[model samples]
Target: MVTTAGSAPTPGTILHLREQGFRVVATDIDPAAPGLYLADRGHLVPRGDSEAFLPRMRALCESEGAVAIVPLVDEELLPVGELDGDGLSVMLPRPGFVASCLDKYVLMRELSAAGIGIPRTWSASDPPPADVVADDASGGFVVKPRSGRGSRGVQLVGALAEVPAAVAASGYRADELIVQERVTGPEFTVSVVVWRDGGVQAVVPKEVLLKRGVTKYAVTRHHAEVERTCRAVQSALRADGPFNVQLCLDAEGRPRVFEINPRFSSTAALTVAAGVDEVAGLLRQAVTDGPRLTDTWREGVTMVRRWTDEFISEEEFASHGLAPAPTVPLVARGDDPAPRPRSTDPASGVAVRAR
Candidate 1:
């Protein structure tokens, strides 16, 4: 299996899978994306929006004899979801599920109607319902792009009147924005792995001690309420692969979720540490016809992330094609393999025989 993206999860996954005897093909649009450095072979490819993207990606797979493609970023998910599979095994939810998750508005509506606790949300084009557009600013709201990543273009509005300008300033049209009541409570980012049969394999809800979109500091935790709520949402979405959910405890301490990500979370290393190894599940699934659904995991594990610097001299950068970045300290580093192409048995569906 070959995975794309050089983000947090991708690097750890590359390391983890490599340790399991899978060759890593690291790819990213940014040449300096640190994960690329750890790949058995790395490709600096075009952005997902480029017309050349899919064609080039398929070409990469065929050229490298890669039978599976794992995507770790949002921008690449939809396009990767469209892959016809051919002889390649790709683990993506259906396109409709991908669409619903990507569009925050739709996702919230669906979840809200499913009896999931979601922040009261408003759309730009539609005048707020009576409860949302009240003159009083009793419930503070946050406005953000309809489809966005991270905390970018997010605006806190004291009252509904402030939403319009915030939406415009956010570089999104009014209809392309969503304003929702701001949540206040300790937050948790829960990741769940599901099989194609709609069976949930595992759920890891980690308490976020600190974060910058990606988890910076976390501890493996098990809140019965949070785990229950996350699984409810997981079933509601019919999520068929690895996906993450963002939830914050409400004033009442209920785990009210606000977002769902249809890929592996940045804390893949943490999950691996916590005994819920997604890369392992994916690697096995990629090579096999199904996934194992037994639940066995370690809880109450802790993780703290620190930066690393992979400094290289100018000549080294030019000669070895180096990048100035470090592996996140929590991510494990494995011995780099000398093999040019990793082996996978298509019919048998095994990467390397369990020896």
Candidate 2:
């Protein structure tokens, strides 16, 4: 399987694919993405929005004889989805499903209409009645672009009056934003792996302990109610491949979904380290019709986040197919020269045995 972005989960993905005896090719626009060094081959590509991006990716796939592409970033998801796969598969949900997930308004409306508990969200261009916003303000309201990703443009507002300023600075039209009740409490992330046929193969919920926009600490903890809720949401969405369901528990410990990523999440490696290797599971289904992997992660496994440094000389850096990393970010702490065999261990935690 081919993976792109060459950072975080992409490196973990390359490691996993490598273990399965697949020659993994990693790509990124930035040479300093850090994940490039871990691949069988790496290439510096143009930005996703560049006109040359698509043609270059096509050429890469053709030259590498890549069977499927496992995209690692949301910005490239739709474009990658649109790639003419020929006979190769792009391990992603349908275009409509992806659109629904990316547009939080659509996802919330569809799910809430289906009786799922979702944050009360409304379009900024067409907000709710005055009294409704007043009522929601008691629970803390949030404003963000309608199609925003993660916490990029999210803004917390004390009252509806403050929304206009946030909307103005967002670089999007007022109507292009989404305002909703802030569902705050204890947050959790659910990593789900679905069969190629869109069957729910596995669900592992990790209680989020710390985060700064993205998850920094996630601990594996199984909550039956959240699992049931996620299962229901998954069935309603009919999403395939790997995706994450992020929610915040109510005072009574019930889940209310605030976000859904129709692609693999940044914390995916943490999910694998905690016990469920969603990447491996997807690869198995994508490459072969294999028996599914059941939930078998050790409970209470918590991952701590921090910056790490890897040192490489000019030759080592150029040999792996990436430009030199800037010197300032090095933090001055790593020196090693070891030539090892291709490892698919992922280096996350335990090696998941392919069933």
lDDT of every predicted structure (CA atoms): 0.71, 0.70
Candidate 1 lDDT (Cα, 0 to 1):
0.71
Off by over 4 Å in 2: 1-6, 129-131, 311-314, 320-355
TM-score per model over all chains: 0.83, 0.84
Model 1: residue 182 alpha-carbon error in angstroms: 0.8
Q: For model 2, what is the alpha-carbon lDDT of residue 187?
A: 92
Show how many residue pairs clash in every candidate, following the order shown: 0, 2
Name the lDDT value of residue 114 in candidate 2. Answer: 78
Stretches off by above 4 angstroms in model 1 are 1-5, 134-139, 289-293, 309-355
**What would the per-residue lDDT of candidate 1 be over residues 103-141, giving only the tens digit for each residue?**
999999999999999988878777777875554446578
Instruction: For residues 114-201, write the lDDT of model 2, one tens digit per residue.
Output: 7888777788887576766557555577888767566777789877777777788777788778888777778999988785577787
